[model samples]
Target: MIIESYSFGRMKVDGIGFDSDLIIFPEKIVSSWWRVQGHYLQVRDLGEVLDYQPEVLVIGTGYSGCMDVADEVKKELEAAGIKYYIEKSSRAVEIFNKIDSKKKVGAFHLTC
Candidate 1:
């Protein structure tokens, strides 16, 4: 990954961005407040990084983890047969780390 920028609590990987405080795994992120800044989960983009079919996609919605993903995107993931997991950032990070060592995973996260 081309990490283009990094600061006290944030980083920009290639064009994908994230916050350091958030925990991330192969498939999910525990917190993703940074997504509001015009960065988000793009399946095709992620697919390029994974280089294979990912079993799941996880999103960490920040604080309460309340964020509504676009319906079309959700449907696309379903069509691709990728599972979706949405949760608070902390828990999402934990799950990501656990599964990352075993298989294909992608994570995006941002912190409060």
Candidate 2:
């Protein structure tokens, strides 16, 4: 999937715009992703993505990068052997647009 544009509180992915946060899988988009703790990411927040077992996980931590992914969450991904990359939402959009993988997933927070 291609992420066309991203801004605070909104994003366009594969030509569809979304106001809420989202997760992009190889086959579909999970359009209403909300973490248990807003602005803080958790492994439980990515249950659906983990279920699909993607080779890589990309996280967009809002427009200015106000959100955070906890150490425990990083540990979980490492233990599960799932590689991850995290950056500001705009930069993430750039990476998502260029990445090439058979099964990579993206979780993007639309606002700070």
| lDDT tens digits, residue span 46-95, model 1 | 44424445676666554455444556667777787877676665565455
- The backbone clash count of each candidate, in order, is 7, 0
Model 2 misplaced stretches (Cα beyond 4 Å): none
What RMSD does each model have against the real structure?
7.5, 0.9
lDDT of 2 by residue, 1-112 (tens): 8887787899988889999999999999998899999999988998998889888888999999999999987898888888888999899888877789978999999898
Give the winner by TM-score.
2
Q: What lDDT would each prediction earn against the true structure?
A: 0.50, 0.89
Clashes of 2: 0
Q: Positional deviation of 43 in candidate 2, in angstroms?
A: 1.1
Error (Å) of candidate 2 at residue 70 is 0.9
Off by over 4 Å in 1: 1-51, 64-67
